[model samples]
Target: MKNTILRFNDAVYRLCIAVAGLSMLTMALIIPWGIFARYVLGSGSSWPEPVAILLMVVFTFFGAAASYRAGAHMAVNMATDRMPPALRQGAAILVQILMAVVCLFMAVKGWKLCANTWNQFLGEMPGLRVGVSYLPIPVGGVLTLLFVLEKLFLGDQSHRRVVRFDLVEESEGAA
Candidate 1:
């Protein structure tokens, strides 16, 4: 059962990475086209700038969730690292609890924001709803929350084989 949950988280982590990467890639493609269209083609495209901005939001939120799971998120641990083992453990629990609270706030408030904005459409991209652009916030919050729960209950899965394929390769090479 623990293995199943870890596998599920691994899949989620991959998905988050994929979404963030695609968003970044698409944004990279878009901004250049917008610049080219304005300077070379003598006409600016209306959709590209707004679309790129939306993509940036998507990239940031999804990438953050994946970063959290991978233990790559920015954390100032110098103070905690200096503590005794028992104090360090307590501090770690406190940090996780704080993380969980922040995640819940993001999920709840983000959903409310989405719902409130659902009726509005972007002027630059008429077909796209404003709410749709904000979807990543709640989604990312939920994903990060899941990772937090996994850590609290199952312990850190960052060392698991599925999460760290590079470690597996290194072990195989040594063997």
Candidate 2:
């Protein structure tokens, strides 16, 4: 059961990472084209700016969730690190609970925002619904919530190293 859950978590993490990476890549490509078209071509394309903004939204939210799972998100651990083991554990639990509450709030409010704006269309991209862009809010929230639950029930999987290297083996192979 534990292995199954961990596997699922790993899959989700990888998926989020992939989505974030693709969003960034698309934004990078689109922005330069937008600039070139505006200056060099003497006319700016309407699609690039809005598309880049949408991609950025996707990148930020999904990237954040992935970062949280990998324990790479910004945190001030100065106080917690100084505490004794028992106190540290207690503090960790408290923080996780608080985080869970925040995620819940995000999920609820995000969904409402998404639903309410479903009828609205983007000015630049009329085919795209404004509400579609807001989807990452609730999706990211749910992902964070799942990660918190995994930590609270199963244990911290963040410390598990995804990569390792052997210098000796590499040197021997070179020789």
Best by TM-score: 1
Deviation of model 1 at 144, angstroms: 0.6
lDDT tens string, model 1, 61-160? Answer: 9999999988889999899989999999999999999999999999999999999999999888889998998888898899999999998888987766
The per-model lDDT (C-alpha) reads: 0.90, 0.89
Give the worst 10-residue stretch by lDDT in candidate 2: 160-169
Clashing pairs in 1: none
Candidate 1: global Cα-lDDT? 0.90
Clashing pairs in 2: none
Residue 141's lDDT within candidate 2 is 94
Instruction: List, residue by residue over 27-101, the lDDT tens digit for candidate 2.
Output: 999999999999999999999989999899899989998898898989999999999999999999999999899
Per-residue lDDT of 53 in model 2? 90
Supply the TM-score for candidate 2. 0.90
